[model samples]
Target: MSAPIQMVLFDAGGTLLGTNTDHPRWYEQFFVEACAEQGVEVTPHQVDEALVEAAREINLTHRSSSDEQVRFFWEHMYTWCFRRLLPNRDAHQLACHYIDRFEVGEYVQLFDDALEALELVRCAGLRSGIVSNFGSYLHVFLDKTGITEFFEFVIVSANEGCEKPHPEIFDLAVARAGVPAGQILFVGDNLREDYQAAERHGMFSVLVDRYDLHADKPALRRVKRLSDIAQYLPQ
Candidate 1:
């Protein structure tokens, strides 16, 4: 028989919190306006296309897990996009402007289900923690969203020098959790990085598919909201 879960581990961004301005074209519109202010005119479609191309190029060459590396990665990617859109302009300046717009406290908010899920874990006498593939600013987001106290520890990729989908990072989290991997329950939104990664390490995992994005992956355990995670835990 499977071990009873003793702790609940969560992924930060999509699982516990999300950006307040969530739209299909938020970045495309943001870049369009940033370019306009710099005496250049670019359409949202142009911005989107440029970003897609830049991201593809950067991903082939960059591996960023540290906070400084994450910053540099974005700067490089956005500068590449700006250069493609406005070849004659100071692309680095435009990239800086775009990055500054996403100031920590202003961009993210706690999910409505976040508190309820944490409370359920606490009420069930289970320990709780976080394992996120985010920069060191993960703590700042937690504090800003007023959820810092809910977790016993917060493991971030930026600080650990590794990110999810890697056994090393999961090894670190498992060690810090102080519980056998089989006795820990991990909940997150990303299927490969969060759900499958945790499962491969011998932990129970629940994919938080808030938009039903993984309906085809029915073989994997999943929930539409964090509150529904209760079904996978003790009474």
Candidate 2:
């Protein structure tokens, strides 16, 4: 079944690593805290709205896979976000500070079952890679979190000039993976981005509902833990 499953491609943030939920804003909480730590307090609501704005604004610009360009895109986004609360000059510098501190792995947390699933992929002789709508930060975060070695390679949207829910990144992953689309499985937490996107490309897809956040979610199949992926592999 499932073309014998030769390679596995996973989404990074929710699928393997997660933003520590010590606060309700989730990742936006970190931005709020990052600024507050600098004696610049911005409301969580402001940061959340601005974060969404930043993503939309940056995506409207042109695309590039160059690492430096990617970092600049995000830095520009940070500036856009901070400016919503601070003056132009303050916002630029604050955004810089946020990026510097954020790069140090201050908020990334790995899911409990992530490592075991990756190890099983390796042990079962399947190649593995991480494909995420992230930037170079993922490379460093994974290394500092001690899970980088498990991935044969990593494909970031910033590194590929495309993001999920679009076929560009998936096509790049397929080419880089060197496997037929049917022989690979894509795992992620988002239904549309991971499951539907990969499935649309002829690859198998699984949603890892590690927290059962979507027990009643419709039309999508999911597993409660990352390690459940082991059941899908050829034994």
Candidate 3:
């Protein structure tokens, strides 16, 4: 068997924190509030549907498109959502306003048990950090959620100039922790980016399978509850 993990690295969005039901509602409310500020009238449901359609289109085209192209697709979607919701406002300004509003505290909510699990990990003498694919505001979100103190490092793809599934980002993270790859444990929801990449780099990897999809993969250690992680570590 492999040695016990001395350090733990986490994927931010789906692994450490459960998705909030308010996530979809936040987008809808932001657009509705922005429309009200602009003196435009539009229903939240209509705007939310347009945003979802835009996201689907972007996801479908992402694999074939360059980074710039993907960004353009997102911009187009934002512009369309804004235009549909507030006909009189400039879409660019509206998009910016939406982003500014998004940076505020009410949009994201942390999972109920996340802090307890994090505390348990910390008390276990394992160093912890976050490797997330997020924009510049990730630190702000973490701070607002009151969980920022638990992490020794926070590496965002936007700041690192690279996203996951790339070995270099993982290399950077390992380097930041000042630990050998073999001594680190990476837990994330993505099979390719989190589990495969970490395993490829010689780190211990845990797959958070909240969906119960891949039960037969013996090479991967799958866990549903974040608190159950303590059981996998050696005392």
On TM-score, the candidate that comes out on top is 1
lDDT value, residue 85 of candidate 2: 58
lDDT scores of the candidates, listed in order:
0.84, 0.81, 0.74
The parts of candidate 3 lying over 4 Å away from their true place are 22-98, 213-219
Candidate number achieving the greatest lDDT relative to the actual structure: 1
lDDT of 1: 0.84
Query: Which of 1 and 2 is ahead in lDDT?
Result: 1
State in Å the error of residue 90, model 2.
0.6
**Backbone collisions counted per model:** 0, 0, 0
Runs in model 1 lying further than 4 Å from the true structure:
24-48, 60-62, 85-89
Stretches of model 2 off by over 4 angstroms after superposition: 20-24, 40-43, 52-64, 86-89, 210-216
lDDT of candidate 2 over 18-135, digit per residue (tens)? 7666442466777776677766788888888888888877653334355676568767888887788565358777777767766677767888788889889999998999889876
Across residues 119-193, which tens digit of lDDT does each residue of candidate 1 receive? 999999999999988778778888888999989999988898888888888899889988899999999998989
Q: What is the TM-score of each candidate against the true structure?
A: 0.86, 0.80, 0.72
Give, for candidate 3, the lowest lDDT window spanning 10 residues: 61-70
